[model samples]
Target: MSSVNLMAREVAAKIVFYGPGLSGKTTTLRKVYETVRPAHRGEMMSIATEGDRTLFFDFLPVKVERVGDCSVRLALYTVPGQVFYNATRKLVLQGADGVVFVADSQAEAMDANRESLANLEENLLENGIRLDRFPLVMQWNKRDLDNVLSVEELRRELNPRGVPDFESAATSGRGVMDTLKTITRLVIKDLRAKRIVPPPRPAPPPPGSAPAGLEAQLAQHLHHRQPPATTPPASTGSTAAAISATPVPRTLTAPAPPRVEPAAVPVVSANTGSKVLGPTSALAPGDLFDHARAAEAAFIAGDYTTCVTACTDAVRRAMAFAGEGSLAQQAFLLHVDGSDLLRLQGLSTLPQLRVDDAAFALYVLMQVFVRLNAVGLPTAG
Candidate 1:
C-alpha cells in the first residue's frame, strides 16, 4: 500500500487518488506534485513498470491549524492507474482516510472511465473499505481539450452521487490547489464527523519507582530466567571410516557467544504496551512490530495470561507515546479501538478497562484470566 501524510492540527488523513490509466491519475498527481511549493510537499514516488509506465504514489506531511489543542496532517496517495495493477490498487486503499476519483473527460474514453470507476468500487469492497463512509471526490481531468464532455454529462454518466467534482487542465495547474484543498477539507470533516480522533489525554502523576522500574523489572525477570542455550550434536565421520579408525568419539559444544551484541533487555515496554505513536511515533516501526509479534505468539500458544498482560502493558505505554488529542490515545475509547481487539482475542469476559493503559489497567486485566465456570477453584478436585 502507499502512504501519504497531510498535517492539519493533530490529525493525519490519508487520501488516495483513483482512476484509469492515462486518465490523469498520474497527471492529477503530477499537478499536485508540481503545484505545492517544495517546502509544503514531500518527495513524489512512482514505481516504474513496463513500457516506461509507472505506478504513482506520494506522501506529503503539512501541518494546518490546531483543532482544540493540537495540530493535524494528512498523507495523499495515488494508485497505479493501469488496469492490470489492481492488486497494488487494492493494497493502497487500505487504511485510506479519503479518496479522489479522477476521470477522463474525452467523449470516446467513456467506457474505460466506467470500467475504472466500477473497478474502484470492487477493489474497495474486496478490502472491506467502506466507499460511502470515507470522504469521496470526483475530478474530470483534461477539461481544457476541445472534445471534453460537459460537467452535466459527466455527472449524469459518472459521479451520480454528486461528490465534489473539479474541472482541470492539470498541465496548466488550474483547479489543482482547489482540488487539494477540497480533499483536505473533506478528510478533516470526515474525521470530525466519525469522532475517530480524540481530544488530548493527560498523563498520570509520575510513579516514584527505582531505575529498575516496572519496565526494567520485567526485562530483568524475563532475561535473567531465560533457559540455558543448547548445543547441537557433533556430526560423526563416515560410518565405515569411523568403524575402521577405532570410532573417535567427540562431545558437542555450544556455539560461541556473539562478539558484539545488543543488550538483552526486552523490547516490549513495561510502561507502553503497544506504542501509540503512529509510524512517526516515539517507538521505532520495528518496535511496534515486535510488540505485535510477541502478543500473537503468546496468544497462539494459549498463553492468554501473557497476552492479557501485554495488552495491558501496551495501554500504559501508549499513554506516553500518544500525544494529547492523538488518535492513539483518543481512539482507545472502548467501543472504538480496544473493544474489538479484546473481543477478537477472546477477552470479552473481562470487564470495562481502566484509563491507565489500552485496557491493561487493573480492572480489565484481572477479568481476562478469570473464568465464570471456575467457581471454588480450590475445591474442584
Candidate 2:
C-alpha cells in the first residue's frame, strides 16, 4: 500500500526484491545504492549469515523522484531467498506497493525459479492482493553465466502474464538500473490511476536530503511565457529561455460567455512533433492546444519546469472555458482532485517533475483542450 504521510507531505511506497536463494536480489539492491547519489539514498541495512547469504532481509530507502508537490520515496527491500525463509518473505511482503521478481537464469535453476514464483503468488494471495492486479516486473539475472536458459523460455514459465521483464547480471550492474526504473514507473502509474495525492508541506528538507540537483535545475527556468505557434530562432536557444528572457504573456481578449454546449475539438496526433492544430472550418485555432503542444516540446527538450508551467496554464484556461455544470469541468475536478491547481504555481519544485507526472499533466491538459475546442467561439482574424 502507498502511505501518504500527511504531516510530512510525502508519499512513500515499498518495492521489494524477491527471488530464489542466491538469485542476486541483494546484489541488485546494493548496485542501486551504489549507483544512486549518496545524498539521495539511505544506508543499506542487511541481515545476513557469516557467508553473506541474507538471513532475513536487506533494506535501502531512496527518494527516486517527485510528482507535483508530493515527493516520492521508495523503500526498497530484498527478502531472504532461501526456501526455509518463506515465512520471513511473507512478513517482508506486507504492505508492498510493487515487486521485482529476480530469477536466476542458469539452466539448472529453472525449478527454483518456478518455486519462487509460486511462493510469490501464494504470499500475495495471503496478503489479499490479486496476483493479476499487482504491479510486478521480472528480472532474468545471471544471464552472463554459461548454460543459462533463454529469456524466452524463462518468460514462458515465470511471466505468463508478460509483465515488464529485463535481462541482467547484477554483479556487473547491467540491467540493475533498468529494472529499478521500470518498476518505479509502474508503481507511479498505479498511484496516479488510483488518484493518490500527497499535499506538499512547508518543511525544509535537511541538507542533502532532496533529489540531487532537482531544486537547482528548477531554479534556472522558474519563469515561463506562452510560446508562439512556430519554434523560436537559433540565437534565442530553448523555448524556456526565450519565454523567460522576454517575460511576456500572450492573451486572447475575447470575452467568454457561459457555454451552454461544449465545442467540437479536433484530434491532433500527439506523435507529430511541432505540428499545430489549425483553425477549424467554424472555430478559430485553439491557443490551449498550442500551450499543450509547447509543454510536450519542452518535455522532449528536457525542460520539465517550463513543460509543467505551460501545462498548468493550459489546464487553467480549459477550466475557465469548461464553466459550471459542464462535463469537462467535472472531469477536470476529478482529474486534478480539488483546488490543487492553485497550489501548483511557480517552479520551486516543478523542475523535479518526473516523466510520469509530466506525461499525466499533459494528458489532463489535452483533455481540457479538446473540450474547450468543442465549445469555443471563433477568434477574430
Candidate 3:
C-alpha cells in the first residue's frame, strides 16, 4: 500500500522490477541507482547467492517529487527472478504501486520471459491488483546482444497488453533512466487516476503564537517586520486568504511584496555539493538576513520559486558568514518545520521541477530561513 504521512506531508510508493533470472532486473536497478544523485537515494541492498544471482530482492529508495504538497518517495525493489523464488516474488509484489517487467531479448530466453510474465500476472492477481489495469512497463533488455529477438517479437510474446515499453542495455546505462522515468510517471498517473486521498491537515494554530520551536523564533523576528513600499508588483501568485502565523503543524504564510528578482545570491551546499543562487556582491550577514525576509514575502505572494531560491541564498550567506556548523545553521535545521539547506540539497536533484512544486519547496525553505535568523536578524521591506 502507498503510505501517506500527513504530519510529514510525505507519500511513499513501492515499485517492483520483475523478470526471469539473469534478465537484467538487478542490472537495471543498479543503473538507476548510479544515475540518481546520491543525496536523493538511499543505500542499495541486495540478497543474492554467492554467484551474484539474486536470492531474495534488491532494494533502493528514491525521492522523486511532490504531489499535491506531499513529498513522493519511491521504494524500488527487484524480486529474485529464479522460479524457485516465486514465494519471495509474490511477497515483494504485495502492495506494489507499479511494475517494470524486464524481458531478456535473447531469443533463447523467450520461454523464460513468457513464464515470468505469467508468474507476474498470477502474483499480481493474488495481491488483488488486476494485471490488465495495474501500472506496468516492459523493458526489452540486452538489446545489444547479437542473438536477441526484435522488439516486435518480444512484444508479441511478453507484452501482449501493449503496456509502455523500452529497449535497453541496462549494463551499459542505455535507456535505463528513460525506463525508470516512464514507470514513475505511470505510477503517479495511476495514483492520481485512483484518486489517492491526501493526508488530513492538522488543526489551525492559535492566533499570535508561532507554531512552536523555530517557528516561534521566526514569528518573533518578523513580528515587527513588513514589506517595503517601492517593491515591484507581482502577478498575485497562489495566495492563501490569510497568513497563519500560529502554532500549527504546517503553517505557510508570509507577507508578500511585489515580485522582483533579488541579486545573484550564491550558496554552496556541503551535503549535495550543489551551489545555491545569491548576490554577487559581498554582503554582510545582516544584509543576507534581509534576503530571507524577502524570500518569506515572495512565498506569501505565491512566488515559490523565488522564495525558495532566495531562502537558499540566505542560508548559504549566513552559513558562509557565520561559518559551517555555526549556531545559525544548527538552529534552523533543528527547529524549522519543512526543508533546510541539507534536506533541500536532495530535492535540488529533482529534474524539471514544476511551478507548484517549486512553490512548495520554497515555502518550506522560507520557514527554515525564518527560524535560523529569528534572533537579531536584519529586516527586509
Candidate 4:
C-alpha cells in the first residue's frame, strides 16, 4: 500500500510479493518504491542477507479511497521471498489482506518455482487460511528471459487451481501495477461480498423535527447495533424515545478529576526514526503520551473538559498516525478502554496544550488513568 487519500476515505489494504530466489521479487518492489511518490509510501523495511537479499521483506502501507459515501482504511504488508526464512514468511502472512506470488517463468528456474509454490501452500495451511479462499494472484515473473516457459505449460503444471495469473517482467516494472490492481479488485470484491459493513448512519434528526421517519429509523438503527447484552433489541422498543438519542447519563459527578499526575523520565527511540515530544522520550510512532501541559493548563485554566479532550485526541490521533497495534497503540488502548473516544458532559471536544520535549512516560501514565476511569459511557453515539 503506497498511499492514503483521506479526502476519498479509502482504507489501505496490506499486500505482499512472494516468490523464490532471483525471481525479481525484490526488483519489482524496488521499482515500485522508486516509481511511487514518497508520500504514498511508509518506512520501507528491507532486510538483506547473503543467501537471499530480502531477509525480512518490504512494507508499503497504502490506502485506497472508496468512491462510496463512507471511507474505510486497509493496512498492507509483504513477506521475505527467501526460502530458509519460512518462519518469518509465515509471520508476515498472519492477518494478511492479500498476496501476490511472483513465480519465475524461466525454464531453468522451474524447480525453484515449484518448491516455492509448495512452500506457500504448506505455510498458508499452517496459518489455517486456504490459499484458494484468500485474495491471491500469481505473477509469472522474469518472462523477458531468453528461454522462457510457455504460458500454457506454466498454467497447466503450476497453476492447477486456475487463478488470475499475470505475465510480468518485474525487473523493468512491466505488469507490476496490473498485478497490484488485480489483487486490489479481488480484495474489494471480497469485502463487498462479506456484507459486514452497514450503510452509513445519518446523524440524528433534530429535536421534534419533521420527517420523523429519519428519527424513527435512526433510533431503531442504534438499538439494533447496541451491545445486545446491555441494551434491549428491536422487538422491545416501540418508538425512538426508548432508544438513545444522545450519550448515556453518567453519575452527575465524576470524582473531582485528577488535580495532578506522576512525573517520569522521558524516552526516545532513535532507530525506527520519528519525532519525539513530552516528558517521556523514545515513545513509539502512532502512540501518544498524556498532554501534561494540556492537563496542567486545563486545571490551572479551570477547564477540566479541555484537559480531558486533549488527552482523548492525543490517544486517537496517535492511532490514526500509525497503523494497527504498534506497541504504543496497545498501551494507549488499554489506557483508554477499548475505544479511545472521550466526550465530557455538556462539552464539545476538549482541546489540548503541548507538553515538554521529554515527557512521554508521564504522558502515558496520565492517559492510562484518565481513560480507565472514563469507561462505560453510553455507546449511543
Backbone clashes in each candidate structure, one number apiece? 29, 4, 10, 33
Candidate number achieving the greatest TM-score relative to the actual structure: 3
Per residue, candidate 3 scores C-alpha lDDT tens digits across 1-381 of 787665346778999999999999999999999999997899999988987898888899999867665678999999998898899999899889999999999999999999999999998888777999999999999998899998899888887889999999999999888888898888888877776747433443555444555444554444333222333334455343123222233233434335545533324343455644333212234455457546545543445556656656655555443335864455544465323344554455554332344445555545544544554343455
Better of 1 and 4 by TM-score: 4
**lDDT per residue (tens digit) for residues 1-381 in model 1:** 222212111466678888877777666677777766675566777765685455645555554555554455557777877788888887888888778888889999889889888998888887776676657888888988989889999999987777898888777877776887888788767776777666444432244432233434443444443333333434575765445554222111122222211122223333445423222112223333444344433432224445555555544433333336653344343223443333333342445221223223223323222211122111222
lDDT of each: 0.56, 0.70, 0.70, 0.57
Residue 102, candidate 2: Cα error in Å is 0.3
Candidate 4 lDDT, 243-353, residue by residue in tens: 733335222122334443422222222344443443321232222334544443343332345454554444445444334665456555555433113112112321332
TM-score, one value per model: 0.49, 0.53, 0.58, 0.53
lDDT tens digits, residue span 1-381, model 2: 788854334689899999999999999999999999996798899989987889888899998776766667899999988989889999999999899999999988889989998999999999999878989999999988899989899989999999999999999999999999999989988887787754343443444444235433442332232332454444656876676555343221112222111222222333464445422212223555456556655554445556566777666665754456554355554454432343344333543545335555655565555455565422345
Off by over 4 Å in 3: 197-381
Choose 1 or 3, whichever is better by TM-score. 3
- lDDT for 21 in candidate 4 is 79
- The deviation in Å at residue 364 for candidate 3 is 12
Candidate 2 residue spans exceeding 4 A from truth: 198-381
The CA lDDT at 222 in model 3 is: 42
